[model samples]
Target chain A: MTERVYAGRPRPGNNFELYSWFFMRISGLLLILLVIGHMVIMHIINNVDVIDYDFVAARWASIGWRAYDWLLLFLALLHGANGVRVVIDDYVRRKGWKVFTVAVLYTFTFILLILGSLVIITFEPIGMGS
Target chain B: MYRGGEGQLSFILHRITGVGILVFLFGHVADTFLVGFGPDLYNHAMAIYRLPVIRVLEVLLAAAVLYHALNGLRIIIIDFWPAASRYQRAMFYAVGVVFLALFIPAAITMIRPLFH
Candidate 1:
């Protein structure tokens, strides 16, 4: 905690933390909605087996499903990745460890996000019947 | 014996769980990508997930998933915001309490579904 003088100038430091602080709140609120909605749709919907290649093929055929899945994918990856980023920011004390861990996390996060989205958008069902 | 284990323990556990979740995510990606190759591979891959031991593992994975998600949200607030540091202790307890509250119900729902 910093002390404020009689003057109006408040404080000076990196605003990166400030933005990340706000990101957590906003993303947390959104994650609650997104994750719950995703769970209900995918998990609790009668039969889990109904969600196959054909099911996904039908769903993503619609722009609505595409948009919904895209948002869910984007939000979840950002939310989880940023979450990991914060953990690294806090615990990885050594400079080398900090850089190494964050870099590794960021690399994997990007790979997962890209792969997940690509699969969701481009699924095909014709091969399933074969 | 676990006295005053919340602060540093929370920090250490969060890192461990985050890495664990990423590992799970990679496995999930690999399994999901198998669907693209063909249905036989996809079905076979999924059947592997249907064993009793795998079911138990899935339950643990779900627990780990929720724990990492909720706790990460809590730490993000305290670390990134100076304002949150004031109520950090309170918020830490709040996070644990709320995580248990939600997680217990979810666990019960999951477990009960199996028995029924």
Candidate 2:
């Protein structure tokens, strides 16, 4: 048995939650295609042993690969980070703990996104010492 | 806190797989970032992934991704089409069937290199 209690608070007009929900569905659909393609190419089409420096170099040498990887990195990270935030909100009751947890998650996500982008965009095959 | 049901199980699995994929993403990004350090470091890191245990983990990852993606589609459909909500349980089972169908072949392919 649940009792309804009235909390005196003004309702917000923003549809942030609605948009976030939509983003999850759309990004998830895209991720399925991107991640499957990535796995198939990296693991199935070619085995792990073959993915040495030269293979990565050649793959990243192309602009297409760079774009594909960059999109995959950004969407996957954002989607996962947002999902984690939802989990944190669900489980964390304390205001301070919730803020701190979300802060750490966002910070790490930011750094990883930048790092991943830089690596994919600036990767040079020739730089690898023979 | 929902009790036992297909809906509850689907919800729980979606959360678990989402977190699982996130963990894998962290390791993956770290390993790929090694490329900036040079080929030796990058290749060395990749070599470590070929171990039997790691290969098994890869299979698990594949399973997670498959379930998440399939269940995600179901979620999207239910969200946009209210009428489909009645078939949510059936859709969950369909996701499981599709996941296993795809995952078993993927797992076999993943481990084939190890034996050869």
Cα-based lDDT for every prediction: 0.65, 0.83
Q: How high a TM-score does candidate 1 get?
A: 0.69
Per residue, candidate 2 scores C-alpha lDDT tens digits across B1-116 of 33469888888888999988997898788889888878878888998888889888887888888888888888877766667776878888899889888888888998888888
lDDT per residue (tens digit) for residues B72-93 in model 1: 6666565456576556557668
Judge the docking of candidate 2 as incorrect, acceptable, medium or high.
Answer: acceptable
The clash count for each model shown is 0, 0
Query: Model 2, A12-117: lDDT tens per residue?
Result: 2469866777788789889989999998998778877788888888888789999999999999999999989888888899999999999998988898998999
What DockQ does candidate 1 score?
Answer: 0.22
Provide the TM-score of chain A alone for each candidate, in the order shown: 0.78, 0.84
